[model samples]
Target: MAHRRPATGRVSTLSEAKASSRAARSRQLCRSRRKAVSCSGAAARQSCSRATWTWSDYALEEAGRLTHPLRYDAETDHFVPIAWDEAFERAGAALRSVADPNQVEFYTSGRASNEAAFLYQLFAREFGTNNFPDCSNMCHEATSVGLPKSIGVGKGTVTLEDFDETDAVFSFGHNPGTNHPRMLGTLREVSRRGKPIIAINPLRERGLERFQDPQAPVEMVTLGATPISSAYHLIKVGGDLALLKGMMKALFEADALDMAAGGAGLLDREFIHMHTSGIDALRADIDATDWDAICRVSGLSRDAIESIARGYWTAPRAIFCYGMGITQHRHGTETVQQMANLLLLRGNFGREGAGICPVRGHSNVQGDRTVGITEIPTEHFLERLDRAFGITSPRAHGHNAVEAIAAMRDGTAKAFIGLGGNLAVAISDPQTTFPAFRKLDLSVQIVTKLNRTCLLTARESLVLPCLGRTEIDVQASGRQAVTVEDSMSVVHASRGMLKPVSDTLRSEPAIVAGLARAAVPNSVVAWDELVADYDRIRDKIEEVFPDFYDFNERVRVKGGFRLRVGASQRQWDTPDGLAHFLVTELPLDVEREGHPYLLTTIRSHDQYNTTIYGLNDRYRGITGRRDVVFLNADDLRELGLEHGDRVDIVAGERELRGQTAVAHDIARGSIAAYYPEANGLIALDEHDHASGTPSYKSTPVRVRRAA
Candidate 1:
């Protein structure tokens, strides 16, 4: 069992701890500690985080304080403790040795503060390279790229308050109870109010079906659970495009029928005419699409899909929420466009209670991008950055995650410096990614705890201990609060209550400054001055991005302010200055003939990203283990396998052997397994071209009983 810290308000007794394990199975079993690890993607986000118990799932408790800076020795296969200055000097030497600055890859994690991320990008550009491969590259990259072309903004348009007035909610491909447990409370309220909540997923997650408020003593006494998801539809893996198209087709058919009855059409013609363009192209594409193919590809009957369309048609205000299931595919960008089209038909944007919501993983994933963490830097942003720092930034495009891995594999990339995160396990196709890391000339990981990526030893690798978000950060100016941006646009300030976990542990900004000072000898910026007081960093940020005008004043005014999004006001900021109803072709062929099953990777209840707290998937009826594949009962019979039988999963030349098979209620021809462990079964190159996001949600594989 993983360690469980006592809740902030008061520690739960042993009876409650035992109850927690059982509660994991029941709908009312959800728990989120009310304390703030707040990193409001800080106006700089300063809002309190509504994340689960202890901020992370036993991550802080498991990795004890006092982790030392260590160097990986290949001869003894051990990590020996080294002084901080030595580690930084060696890292600087390896970076300087690289003939071409572009040979080094600089990566950032979502957990980093806005200040940390800004300095990270600044350091890389100062070192003369634009190579940045961050965590968003593997997830939500499609949302950041695809949403902008259609709506003029990449972030979600709706706020938390939107759920309050939404007449209906449509969710796809994610399990919130495990991913964002905080949102389940909002969902519970929406469901309690009698609004319709429709769910479309391959596997029927227990969290989306029902939830009981453990916080409400009334429910605890009565053992009453609130029912969620008014209607649940099982869509096959790689079926998002088809399902979205089918819904649009049904709406068009409904519009024609309504118009013929001598009444107002189903389409919001006025809103579409005034705020959008390219409706004709989208209409034509849907008209030419075959209903039979949509049904076959989506695995949903026409009537069933039409029923969902009716739910959308009847509701005056509706919000569409989705996760990697829609964006981790070859057609991810197109799928996002199609979703924008669906909401446009009803004028869902800029309105309360309605719009597109893409739940981003990690606290600051969106914030990192907002502060300029990208391989392709816009001319305007680059100019502003250069002007703010009085330095020249490269305008050439550089490698993303996929490109970085490929460059390393081909011996073109030589060094790696990670701001945070377990990138080695997070990225797919470990076969190629792991070896690429091993061959690097140097690697420097800035982290609080040990992870798989820390072990991917290069010629000279260093693991530098950093302060966790839960600990206080005192710079030369004394105790300072860091801001963070949430999935929503709101930024909040985070103040850690705990004392420094380790005397030697440094904050991310300090570590970044250390790296910058050691790596860029000719650097003009005063890194020490900036690190003395974070206010100086904020002032620099204000100069670079105009959104943060009154840098220090606005952030301290209560809750952090929200960044302005043009789409929120129905103001299209696209090249044409209008929202678009772009067309996406239906994806009919997804699997190879020999690949009978489609396997999708998922995180367990005990897991948060690549950090494993324990081995248990409580909601999926899994506990104490992760080596299990979930297959439909009928698929199990077809393959002559039983619930406890061992099997081998193959994708191309890669194989995951001796996996226990579990008979589940998942959609036929679809399989589910825990991520990172099953990452070997996915190909590194299998990703979306436009956004470069790996196809982890849907992969065709062959499953056979093991000897």
Candidate 2:
């Protein structure tokens, strides 16, 4: 798995003269990309993983940073600066007061580094609980749960290098320009070479239409934007499962016709016979599926679905890329499983140009989980962790975000500790989530900036300032480097060039060690020793998770290293040592309940998660506004509403009132609103049953004209 990186995540074989220019530009693009589009701080750790470099909307994240520890004073209704010693003591007391370790909910964000996440989990498990709820659970949990069930691994099979060999790229439910602009360089190359880049999403995003490469000087001087999508098809929100089944059905029907005519079938019979299981069940389901039902649910005609199938069948090697749009639904797990099924039909596994790419948003959300930030730990993992730490860690299943909310609301959980996210606004049903958080005995936020979540006071609340990503961390071992794993499973070192925001600000690892030392004084985990030297922590991680063997040596290498992905070589690690074709029935419909429309949550160009950098959404052409709902122009007139009418976004008993409605190019029954704000109408309990991910992308709602 140890290898040098090229312009992409994989090696490229471009013409000699072009390679030099492309490589230089790629280096420049990734460097500036991080500086321009980063909220997750950039560290000083040396890395050559060009594809992993990310940056976006940086000013708001760095502005008004927290420099000192704060304690909430209820009488004054404000936070006053307190010394770190008192903050740690109060936090230790609060954690100690909880009768059971399970009564504490430990939360982690995607921005947390691998070293810090490892230490955080070790500290929590040492205290006798695995109550770890991470940000991945809110975003890509379906991919984590569903992909492994099919492909034997949860990570993407193809690196950016695969883009070189791919004949086509299929994009689903994602906006590359706003969310992950780094990918645009790869997509731009694909389009310029006359390869098809098919886009399927409910909203007509500007990113999918055309893109101007800031790195391409020729294109820049001409001011010409290259066409990105060969065809942009609008699929109804929450209708992916239905659309996927229909696509499969079209292929299956075509195969039957071809076989009857004494021609070879379209499906890869050899791959099916040699490498996969559960084909009969899948074939039966596709055959039995009614076309009428498919058309009704998918919101696409039979001809439209068949045309997409034609495009897929013609491409010899294609990469399927997706984002939260495919995962944030009630049936999100099944939808992800079907994506694999469609690819398996053409034998796309292990090919250079073809594989499923679950395009993750956060830089190290994947890394956090890799270093054991999961609430549900494998039995083997727990056994090794206990053996390494010399303590009996708890085996009971812990609370996720939903269960954590329920526990806190029912008074079963008493304490909360957040590593880096805005849990208060991040949690849905603010009417309920806000109060449940307030009732907690303790709440601690280890953050770099002051956010709304820090203001959600409990009986004891502390805001502890910590080091951000783009800052130096001079520890006992001198300037230290932390490691992070990108979506492609590339592990790289990251160190910040910027100095500390304040002399008082501590690193997250240091803060966690302080809390651990005070809370569990005699724990054998050796929190202090691990915090002082991150290399020792890496060694410990390598001992526990052998996937990271020789971690310290490999991480320091240029471009870092690639963790072994068995599925990349067609080495299936499933129970029977083969990939699977899982089958799940499509629901009768994505019912709107009492509402006549469906709402999907989105992020603007000027926004990242809960942070709003500015009011304008450049791509959508909205100025000084975040309270606009995007609806189809035809649907707007049908509902007796104009393009700029003020309406109440309602979901039964909940309402986000007086929101300005803006007509746009979305599907007929589908509407779009910015997320973490539209969350008011979404219930905390409403999420995928298996992965526990909120239905952020597909929520049924009604919009009524306001007085």
Candidate 3:
């Protein structure tokens, strides 16, 4: 069981003694695992286990605090500390140098707050461009693009309360323990009730198998781990589309036999006729999908696929949950629609404990989009913004992450302003992106800690330090609390309790206000007044998005409030005012000749996105290194290789050499490696045409002996 220091405010002397004793035991355990007798004292380790290290551990122990603003010196090829005024001046000049606002791209990270994101888009539109390349383009763009076409909303409809009554949960392509630890408690309770949890993924994660809650003292101290999944299915890379179709086919076949016997069918006929359209086309497409092809592509027997279908049929209420694994594919958007189709088949919308749940990562990614941080903005949102701020906003569509990178590569984009994320490393094809970034005339990074992206210097780069979520944010108005929307669309306030790491650190809102004032001086929006109090910002947001009426008051309530979703009420906002079942064609390029192995990039357990906490992945049983690839032992035997053999991977024109291959329980013909490092294997152009999301989960690669 993993040990975490409980946030019990202050500790007593007894608490300190217990913590010291626990720390000593932890250090001894680590030493025993490594078979070393010598010790390095208590300064060598933190409170958590080797796998789970808190953010403070990373900031204090790994990467030191970034306390001042920095600028890149071209002559010296290094970063030097500079004044905030000078950094903003350089950033503003670069923004002004571009003759066309379309040539300047603004990127945002998911960690930013609602107030910051709203101001960012307002500034961009006022500056005469909409080139908003955000982190969502690389992660959940499929959900944003597909769900709107199918159910008239892009977010999940179920709330936390719905979990109590849920009969079954179908989890796909996400590891809750590492990615979203908070969800493990919910799943742990759900599992204790003996509800069925069907897990589908290429890798058999330890978290999904068992979890010991640190919050529960007995569970942690007694080593009582609760079982999470009732059954775990290993799907092949890029095989979700076939597997989903197979489940629906089995259900449809069962319904047909029931109807022939003069009995009521499994499907909701009245709901289908009244609330949905294009069923005939969808049915025909599903019927046309051959079982043999489904079995071959999905790497599952017919019986296994039907067994999953049986769970879906038996459950009166079910919630289908998925993550990036379902979205990071060439046909990711279509795959999302299929999941919606399955839910709609049973009239799951607007019902208790039932809906499509796309579990989002990051703290407020959903809220950021809700507040209008998108490349493609609707005309209604633009018109409202123009009316509210009395500014003529840009009506042209903007570049997504992929397009923004290409623009930088071709020298079309002159400047890049990042709000929070490590954009280059987070996106695919770093080999091309790294060079493209160097060609940029200006690059600005608003961050709290040093990262690989901060080090990637441009002609004129600025690394501006900002207050993190854990620090108090004080502006002209007074102390402030920013709001973040969860994966379930619950908007809540997050107040910082700890003091600032550095007195020089500024809030994201203050930083954006400074940039906006210098960049676009003529804009009529009261940038300073908006930043004075977050209530005024919420008011402006409410003015633009009427769905958030009484935003100031509603956000103050406990657990906050939920944004208006038409599909949650069974009110389809599609073109025909009805949910449509989309007919999709399976991707033809799923399998490649010679490139028999499909390599997927994954994050280590000790890392969050691109922020490496330590050189370890305890759940996967890896330590002290990330330059290794996980492969099935049978695949190694077939290739005439051993577990620790050195290999070079080739994907299309990109190559990653000398990666150590480790035998694991991953699917046959599939391989996994730590991300950002393996990002070079993914090509820039290889992405979903509809969503522009890179195929990060399934890149066809050839592994050979490293000569």
Candidate 4:
């Protein structure tokens, strides 16, 4: 039996030490067994062993080095370790020999720092191509494209402080416990304060249900988890747009009732009159939408929708937060706009606690876009950049991730340079994407770990290993702390604590500098000097973008500083002086589906993007393997399948001709499969027309028992 310990924050007691040991022993026991068992049953047996495992042991396990480091192989599939200098020279020559500037493409990942990202974009633009495909294209392109039309900016309006003061929190399509552990603390505090957290998702997530913060002393000691969501509404997948529209419709009806009762302060009439346009058109659309149609489409009854609207009306301030689940749909851009429309009805933007929050996946995805990693080139940014750097930045519009992949497969793109990210695993249509990668004249990757992308070798492939976020980066000028912008646009300094795993490992910035120096021999900037001290790079950034003025000094502050967003102050950056309202027509196929189901990809609790930490997904009651899919019990019964029975999902599209995935537990009609695994089933060109973001959420598919 495990002994109870004190909730004193520190793990010091002898019983606590003993409990951790037992937990490890149990895990070892489970691993030693060959047959598959229930994860809950495994947990029950391991509970005694878990108490014996220390936090350090868990950390070490997560930080284990790759047994086989990726290297360049000239002959077979096996990678042979080569010198860094040799790889760089070969990569530079291959890139330089490329015939056309448009033939080369550069990809950026969210893990890259602002300085490295800025330098990467500069290098690509100066190289005479605007083909800067980034990770943002896959995640929050909807928010980036939608929010500007609604609130004048692409970023979330609220800060960490706003979570404390808000009366209500509305979370849509995001699981804070696994994706962002820091957010769990905020939600727990809100739950403790008796504030309602309304969660709208198709599947009930464990993190949203109850979260046991490993950092919390009392919770950790008691093994108790705090309940997060006050109300959980399981809406049908791809029905978010209809659901949001229904909510707005309910709000309008409620506002009408308040007006009839002679209430003057029910709606923000002044804000609508002064700051917005197309109110009449929006009102007409809401009035035209029948409650029954809304209810049927959204998978919610009229009373239930009304109840949620009343909660919104009752709360003084509310924060609307969404994740990739909202942004990966076919109508993702319009869905985001609907969210904005709901917020605008209450005048949520430009306020302290009430605003839009698009929970970004990666650390610096937003920052990378801000620095100029864009397919759509802004003339103002380019003109300013050219003047600052004394080099002509590409002005022509270029390809996004999908477009780049298409170009590569079609033999239009000859060279591929990824600063960081697992392009092969992250992209859709691996069958075509892998073949395209192999066709590259030069394929250069700046990576930290061994991934599937590194295996797609080109005629001239090079892998430059870099320091991880947790690893110390020492240079000629001494130690350096990299700056990363969070989901809220808060740029903060992250100084590494651990030493580099390998002596040959280089900093991302240093590696970029070396490549830039080798590729462009007559370059004006002192690449080595800038790499020595990152402050110089920041200085260069300040020179290029005036918005980042005094970058070094400002980053020295504790939480760093917020980048100025002109839209927050009611400054419109659109073509017109005012925000434009564009009408979107929902596709008939999506609206009138007879199957009554929509599929969406999800990240497991033990995963981050494409990185598979482990097979067990503790939140969704899935364990041992990642092959199983989550499903509704009714849907399963209707299909004549059991929990453990395997089924093949064939996406109903010609482009996905040979794409079929086998999985189990997915909600009936509705299916939840892991991303990249399901990515191939989604067509390449099937994306949001406005933003060019692939429709990862709403893939129409037929499920059948596997042979």
Candidate 5:
């Protein structure tokens, strides 16, 4: 077999390759560092030892330094470091001074542990507000909101073990190689079994096409990469919902044909009758949609759609996995529900090697939300929480990320306490988000690294450095293990081996506990004691959530345990006590008016979420630049533009506005741009009303030559 070589055309031993990669990475870092120092107009070769600096010294100096998380700073910004006791008093005073509990919002990041998140929510609820706007609101909120209506569970149903028995794996709108590298091992195993892996995305990612496992001896020695995508389809941006509907339509048609030929076992007639509803409505909708519309929107031919659907139907068991791509659209919630509907039609739920999987971006994002980081407060959960902590929990609904920013901008919200997150930089419409931060009476941030959010300083702002996941967290008791929940809803323990970067830093749990102790006078629960021993925190968790019964003991068992998902067991937790089907009216306009193209934001392979590891997007054949945009070859011809031509993209209606032009390999009638940079073009109000998630994937824009 003839093997393909990388563009560099140089092959070496695995060790040598790794060394070269590291060296190149190091050189880039050094150059960036030097440029940063030069830009700051400071002495490039200053010695920090002259200032008697400690690890925390650097953090203290850079606390409110950089204007934005993505920008560089020239001079160190000094902050008056206060004593721990003084900090506690200030925090408590700030909380007490708040005129209304509704005015204060508690923000959580994916970096928060289960214990800290639970405590943070408890403290906020007890403080008289349930305004827990977590990181999930910006990312996978659609999945959490959509899945329940479709199949009865918000979390993915398949366990890691199910991958072993999968006959076919369908992945969409996610890049696993960079976002979750651990999943590559599972993909490799599935490939070894000769199972077909289908990938549907606008970009042809290298990991989806081929991957070389550094841990494999045979593949490493042979200098080979495994082929991942048996069938790769480049669907147009925002076309996933249509593509999914088309596939289901094909499957239903195929099932009818099979039945006409006297095949009774082809479809799960029994399961459909017992476990689902609204099949007739779904069938009618699929029948009404024409083939031409599906093909044009999906950028796939009728034959291609049929072929993929045929393969899916032939498989005894399959798993459908998706990422932000499916959840960042105008119809993000509908997209997720369609995925659930696809699974349900085939009896995919409650079975081995079958289910819907929404790959979470952050390690502990799902866990934080599970432990009470939510805008919508549940009555039963709060009542149980009140019993456990001996405090009256607030029942008032609070703001999500979008509403929180709106509140702050309008002076409705006065104080903001971020448990862990880059709120100002992460939210849409920075023009409003940054100013809202400045308007806050008190802005408290507990973080591990420096980010732009810290620079949006309040009149009385404090930056408390905290421990990173890679660092050891030691409290008064001893070393500790923080717990997190995976995409599949399995709760597990994570213990850090690396030493703390700074002695002044505190654990997330400890920071939350410190604030709780200060804010709540004569608190019944021992905040400090819970921080010392995480098991006690889990005991409280078990009391509130019945699924976590025997939490401490169960977590000790190697894989941990899965939280109960009623949907997987054929139990619908909906208002009607049945899985309901929602009908979405498709837009008549196939393409954006006047503009010959559509635009979507994508992540580079070297990046994870908002963190850019390097400039190179190995999958897209790009190197050393993020400003470049992607365009389809046919679209380029249609627009009378060549490769690297500057094109402006205009987004927003009459009020909100933005425009950017860049050179980019995106599909015809579609354009691709990097996030955070493009995020400014989107408005805060432009989100799913039901889920409150930003429409990051499908932003209608007009493209033309830049003046």
Candidate 6:
């Protein structure tokens, strides 16, 4: 793909000239590397390093564009091209066949724009069902569930500007280089400015260690990679709860010591007394937690815990940023609360550079929820939506992603309509999930490209290809732009610049409008009119969601506007009108005596969620294969296994056979494997009790040498 950069002048800036030279040298290096490596299959592409063009990237460029809708023929076990009219006719007929609206489930991906998501949930509500199972339920549901109870909001309060003033940044359970590449640039600047960065994860990620931004010519050409993490801790999988508690225990001791010496306490006593509640209970819990148990469970020494506490205690402003590692667990909600608790102890909220940041997985996952794609809708939101659309929205709570899967398995749900996601592959226990798709009466996917989810094939399955993010979307009102909310509370308009890959493909809003018109022929809302102009959709959205009062006008601005974050302004929207601290228990129930190893599923450098861009995990030095399991050298010795040995991973009643094991720098007694492939080992039932988010980060397993 050609990069969109500004034109250089005859006499270029020193930085620009350096960047140009580095870019030229990088291209030369790629050509030389191409001669030495073979980029053929998808697996090979996945294993190829980022500098080299992988087979999958080449395939996408080489293969002609897909320009038609497909219908799955179960009898022939193949996908056959079908006209748009036939595809919609069959999908509409299937929806009509459903005896009750509750039998149909609408699953949405984070990739869907705000315009599309708003229309989708609105249509589902009009159809008289709240069965909105979304992508957030699987990833950051913990943040959504826990942060609201703590800070009165689900989103990260800090913006891109906040990072500039932060004294310290705590990174927990996330890899910035691959998951969010743009973040690496911010981290590079932070490091250069002499701020302390503490990285906490089971594996020592390369991105956290050092970074060389190609966009900066001097850094890339001079090999002057900025060092990131000042302190790195390898906390055990499922040990975040223990680690957090240990840090708090250390902080309490420090506070007491300082107070006895006629000095102010380490904690912000004013913030706790004025803005928060339940500190006594939290203090009692921390006092009761034994240091020996904390060390054993966290896999960190008491001294190390104290050092972590000292860093936070000394920093004027610190930001706690976490990813799926903290959320994809049995006690994901509690873990999130603990992070919030740590931040609140230091008066992090309402500050310019300090806040709890949940690094979201997708670009617009937060936006989807903000625009009302939730199973559990607020009464106020429902009332407003009802008032705006002249229809009574459902009050009863509906199924989340996990519950949706169970609903399908038990035949409670018959029809499934996916709005831009590979639900089957991304979900756990594919052994049962794949068969559940077959049992569905109808399955329809709105996608930009073919994926495994489309091939699962229900009795009547239709694949309606849609316009991608890079393509221009032309509606009845000519060109249109869609809005998306980033991880922070900022909402902005996204206008596609490239031409459409195919004229047959439609925008997400157009397809959703088509389905809505067919599914509810006599609907009170004008579906066609809404799609005609996206501005009208934003107007309706403002009517339903009060936060976006001047949605259309404000969104047209260059940088857009930020939603009202109460916690950011020292205003809490809780029942007591104050932030609250909650006490949490450790996840001792997740421990298994029989299974000595804790397995965490991770994504490769070449992949984004389930989308495979190549075969290489360049940062981790992984190349040419995705079947290797990362293990500690000592653990390998104890298990009587060596590097290159084939092993079978057994978790509960399921087993993944013939995976090669390689010794690495991961925590002892914990193993790491690729996601989706390792997802089969995670049971559908094993999830956080509070959030219903799958425990993908910490699964107890036993490894055996495969014959």
After the best TM-score superposition of candidate 2, give how far the Cα of residue 502 lies from its true spot, in angstroms: 0.7
lDDT of 5 by residue, 1-707 (tens): 21222323121224345644654655554444333322223432231222312212122223222111121121434343455677777878988898898999799988888988998998888788988778899889999898877876688888888899889999988878877688888888898899999998887677777779999998999999898889998888888888888898899888888889888745677888877788899889989999898888877888988888887889999899899988887788988888887877888888888888898988889998888888886788888988988999877789999999999999999888998778776777777888898898888888754455765767666767677777888877788888999988899888889987556667788878888888888778778778888888999999998889999999989988899887667777887677666666554443667644556777777665655556566566655555556767677667776555545667744212222223333455677788766777678887877788887777777656655
Summarize candidate 4's per-residue lDDT along 1-707 as a digit string, tens digits: 22222322122345334645654564564353211111223322321212222222222233334221234445543344556677777777877888878899889999999889988877777778999888988889888888887767788888888888888999988878778777888889889999999988877777788888888899999999899999988777777787887888888888888889889745688877777788888888878777777776667778878888888878888889899778888788998888888877777766777877889989999988887788887788888888877898777899889899999999999999888898877876776788888888888888765456765777777667788889998989999988888887788899999987767688889888877877777877677888899898888888877888889999999989988875556565665645544444433466334445577888878788888666557666554445545667677677776555556666654222212122232333567777767787777787877777787787777666666
Q: Candidate 3: where are CA atoms >4 Å away? A: 1-61
> What is the model-wide C-alpha lDDT for candidate 4?
0.74
Candidate 4 residues lying further than 4 Å off, grouped into runs, are 1-71, 575-582, 586-588, 591-596, 653-668
Candidate 1 structure, TM-score to reference: 0.91
Model 2, range 518-579, lDDT digits (tens) per residue?
78878777777888889999999999899999999999999999998888899898999989
lDDT of 1 at 315: 93
User: What are the per-residue Cα lDDT tens digits for candidate 3 across 379-449?
Assistant: 98999999999998888899999999999999999899999998988899988898898898888889876
Model 4, TM vs. native: 0.88
Clashes of 3: 0
Tens-digit lDDT track for model 6 on 1-707? 21211221111234445644554554554454332222223322321222222223223322233456777655544455678878888988899889989999999999999999999999999998999888998899999999899989988889888899999999989989788778888888888999999998999888998998898899878988889999999988888888899989989999999999999988999989899998999999889989988887778888988898899989999998889999999989999999888889889999888997889978899999999999999999999999999998888899998888888999989999999898988889898788888789999999876566766678898878789877898888999999999988899999999998667888899889888878888899998899999999999999999899899999999999999989999899888998988898765665697898889999989888987665557777665456668888799889877766678899988998877676778988789999878999998898988998989988999998886
Question: Which of candidates 3 and 5 is the stronger one according to TM-score?
Answer: 3
**lDDT over C-alpha atoms for residue 326 of model 5:** 82
Root mean square deviation (Cα) for candidate 1: 8.4
How badly does each model clash, as a count of residue pairs? Answer: 19, 14, 0, 22, 9, 9
Poorest lDDT segment (10 consecutive residues) of candidate 1: 31-40
Q: Provide the TM-score for each candidate, comma-separated.
A: 0.91, 0.91, 0.91, 0.88, 0.88, 0.91
Residues 482-516, candidate 1, lDDT per residue (tens digit)?
Answer: 87888888877787779875678899999999989
